[model samples]
Target: MTPQQFLQQKLQSRQYAGSYRKLQVQNNLIDFCSNDYLGFARSLELSEMINAELQNYPTILNGSTGSRLLAGNTIYAEDLEKLIAGFHDAQACLLFNSGYDANLGLLSSLPQRGDTVIHDELAHASIIDGIRLSHAKRHSFLHNNLHNLEQKLKAAHGNCYVVVESVYSMDGDFAPLTAIAQLVKQYNAVLIVDEAHALGVFNKGLVNQLQLQSAVFARIITFGKALGCHGAVVVGSNDLRQYLINFARSFIYTTAAPIHQLASIKMGYHLLAQSQLIIDELQIKIELYKSLMGDVPQSSKSSGAVQTLIIGGNQPTKHLASNLQQAGFDVRPILSPTVAEGTERLRICLHAHNSTEEITQLTNVIKINLHVK
Candidate 1:
């Protein structure tokens, strides 16, 4: 029962389950698994833009020094919140250290003791964790199934909140937001959309892209993935903003992100706004990938940066990923219980910088490995 012994047993259990994860250093292989959809992570022009923006704040405070509730709230923080709010066309925006924190704080704080939180079964782990931390009763609808969600909402007793991802991270599919939004209204439930995978892929996100901003109750937008920066923002009403400030423990307890991180987020938005040609190129690459993947087992056909090729089983999926890596691709395997046992996959991320040749080569390699066309 010693703590060290307990930790060791858990690690052993993970190893046995074929889901143990470890940190990996970057390799110079052709990119296929990273979330850097817009290639902003490797954009030298973006780095220079951020550096130039930081120069305006010559006396930059390296860190926020404390939580937003305490010493962390700076003019920069306030301004950034406003800037983000304006960009997202929301009443208010509250910053969190990460997308995880944003979802954690929003779900944990907003839902009350009697409130019911019904989320998609395939929603991100952060949403699940946040729900676990809350006192609200939880239910999970089938992924992107409006009928199932309606049934859940119909039976719910208290304030109901429907949670979904704009673009699901695993299967790389979109939630039926327009349909879901209508359902939420019909059921008198609030809708919370996690736009983590939607930002750079769909201008601002599906909410903004489809003009569903006013329809959604709240949105969680992160900079790390598509923006290729750090931190996240929760877009909602002014009242919700104030409530989360006072009640969201994750936001209240965590140290604010550094000044440089905030500057990077701002610059990232600037780059995204001005990168039409780059974005168009990414779309072209994605189309090329889809056209080339004639016989590939695509989990979903929703158009976005992420695509999952379902390769069943842990060992087999891992082997395929390893083979792809050895063949000079950076693909990674998604093992169970991260995904269902029979649905383990190789998650591929198409980037703006990925050439048509790389896309064709990647698809061919996958076809050859998987014995497809």
Candidate 2:
């Protein structure tokens, strides 16, 4: 067989072996699988704000014509950064195209050569990829294990950067930030927290709510998930922000986020403040879901908004998610390659708009469809 044919044949085997992936759009189901945590994405209030901003800025162009350094540095990006900085109580902020780009830009550029980056073993792909792009030494500790991380930190390493996510995306678990921050202080290392999954859900990310900023080096905030908009912001010292503008290749090379997107983020923040309905509703749903799910089995450490069911294979995870969809819930599987071989799962995403009845329905549907009983 030709080389290409051989490759495709092996790829087919990968699927049969339970790790292949293909996207499917499942419609007509109650959502248990979207990142629209705060219901802001569908809010008429946010859309109207965007419309109003565009109307006011008559001469402002649609696209950020070039990278931020070139032509993309619009007035809106600058203002939005300032707004975020003030809101999050940080000295300065740098906006990236998205959470992925933000992670790529910062993790790839900072923690220079001779520096050590000790990250959570279960950190999102973006975090790992960003570290891969860096010239620093990288290591991963057991997920949320402070002692494990402490041991690694004690081993050979130069100036260390302790990295973790506020709300882990895959398992929906949280890092022990206070302990991690204290350890970071003892080690005299820099602490960086990624608040990607925690932003609007926990309010301004875990770092802000817990008052961990003074102990950490930087906090990564993504507007896409909780803010329910586009783009991300890195909040830290002014020098760090300036350094990213100068050295982060992702920021230097990519086109700046469009003006409307930035405006939408700004609008979303205001909406979050004006009415706590969406966030409160989400908390209620979360509490209800957790109560019904019965302590999350301790075995399932990752059961936040992004819960992992750990059903054991791509086909099983996919099959279970499909069955749930048929039962009127939009659950999606995190297939093998995305996770470890035996840890594929139905990555359920809980939303603020998800009603109590919907939550109960999904829970019943999932357990039954997966034949857990």
Candidate 3:
């Protein structure tokens, strides 16, 4: 078959599955579907802080000239890594351009030949991809099923790494971290927690929040979501950081994050350091959103920023999301194969800046559209 025909077949398959995705422009809808949990993404104070931090540098460099191992390694970048490591209570921190790169770098490089890499079935795509890239044996436990994880751990053949997200992105649910930690300890398996969605929302993440830093072998934190910035960091022991610098292809081969992005990351952390009020406001809004929904099936058990409303079929889920958007709420449908076919959902991301009235209206419209009332 011709190349065009081959691509057409793939596109048709996606269309038939009702999961064809397309680019969408940002709209002026009432916000209910973004990761800016603390409103730092739109913070005037944050913008000003970035500007002020920019002025501190001796020279204005538009880009990181090379990889961190090469010309890209700067005193500023290394200083920020030190600050991040201290803030996260890690021995060392290594930066990546995004969470995808961090996960890809960590998972792909750490699990060696004959090692076993078991992750949650619902782990992020990047994690799964990284596992695929490794020479290790890989398996997945049922999502958040600790018993399944234990079984997998028992049967693991070699050195094992157990992976999970502290807060699962699509489902807006959390892993049973403390229980998982116990399992990891019992099995003598290394644990890796991706706190991409949990960082700003949970102060430092579930690991830091629960003082489980010592329990986990490594943690991946990202700035793109709740931190309202760009980039990610893998926080672990100094040895692991050094190893990643030497071996992680994604990190070793790519250009470093620009100075301005690093500035945003640094300033974002400074804000998080003093953001008890913002976090409190966010908790209040989360409660408000839940109470306003009033028996609407919530996908998240924790008071995290993400919430999912399950709609079984792709067409129905998309239709509901479109209805909510038409009513001025920016609700997005999480369709298969992004999620499973029967578990497609409308992913609602509550924010600190979202008003009670807006939340109420959004839920009421959802109820009216779905005939829930």
Candidate 4:
């Protein structure tokens, strides 16, 4: 077949499976779809703080003209890393353009050919992609199955590495971190936790909240979710930072984030440090949502910002999401292939800015639409 025909075949296959993806513009509706768990993305106060922080770096360039190994490194950037490292209680911090890059760079570069990389099956696509790039032997345990994880750990060879997310994105469930840490320690394997969904939602992150910082080998924290900014950081030991600086293709090859982005990160942390009341407000909304959901059939048990309602088919899941959209709630479907075929769902994200009335309305709409008791 011709190249066009090959591309068409793949596109057709996606369509046949009801998973054809499309780009969408944000609509003016109540948000139950975004990753802005703390609503920092839309916070006027945060925008003002970012603008003020930018003013402090007047002489800094608008763009990082080159990669950090070249001309992009700045005292401001280093200082920001230092600040982040200190906040997370890590020995060092290395910044990446995004969580994907951080995961890719770290996972791809660290494990050698003879080493093993084991991750939770429900770990993000970025984690999977990163492992694919590595030359290491790789395996995935069933999601949060400690026995399966232990089996994998037992069979692992040559500098085993265990990876999991502090808060899983799709299901919004937490990893068995403390137990996993103990298991990894028992097996003498390194542990890496992605705190992408847990960072701003749990203050420093679930790792820090649980005081497991020392137990982890590295923690990947992103600014886009709860922080409502951009970029990511790999918080680890000083040696790991230096090793990645020398070897991580993603970090060494890509241009560093601009001064404005770093300033935004700085101010984001500043706001997050003082956002306990805001965080509590988010928890209140979550509890309110859960209470309203009230054993609704198909609802996933989640305490985090992300909640899922399994609809079981792509068409039905999409239909429910569309109905929610029509009701002025921006709830989105997690379709087949993104999730398993029979487990398609509506992923609802709660935010501090979301009101009790909104949560009540949303739950009521879901219940009425599902015809639940």
lDDT of each: 0.90, 0.83, 0.91, 0.94
1-373 per-residue lDDT for model 3 (tens digits): 9999999999999999899989999999988888999999999999999999999986878998888888888888899999999999989989999999999999999999999999999999999999999999999999999889999999997899999999999988898999999999999899999999999888989899888999999999999998899999999999999999999999999999889999999999999999998888999988887887766663444579998888889999999998888888999999989988799999999998999888888878887876776
Error of 1 at 351 (Å): 0.3
Candidate 1: segments with Cα more than 4 A from true spot: 298-300
Error of 4 at 183 (Å): 0.6
Per-residue lDDT of candidate 4, residues 1-373 (tens digit)? 9999999999999998888999999799999999999999999999999898887767877799999999999998999999999999999999999999999999999999999999999899999999889999999999999999999999998999999999999999999899999999999999999999998888999999999999999999999999999999999999999999999999999999999899889999999999999999999999899888876978976889999999998988989999999999999999979998898999999999999999999999999999986
TM-scores for all candidates: the values are 0.97, 0.94, 0.98, 0.99
* Clashing residue pairs for model 1: none
> What is model 1's C-alpha RMSD?
1.2
Better by lDDT, candidate 3 or 1: 3
lDDT of 2 by residue, 142-212 (tens): 99998899898898377899889988788898988999999988888889999888878877677888888
- Ranked by TM-score, the better of candidates 1 and 4 is 4
Best by TM-score: 4
Model 1: residue 34 alpha-carbon error in angstroms:
0.9
How big is the positional error of residue 146 in model 3, measured in Å on the Cα after superposition?
Answer: 1.2
RMSD of each candidate relative to the true structure: 1.2, 2.0, 1.0, 0.7
When 2 and 4 are scored with lDDT, the better candidate is 4
Error of 1 at 305 (Å): 0.7
- Candidate 1 TM-score versus the reference: 0.97
Ranking by TM-score: 4, 3, 1, 2
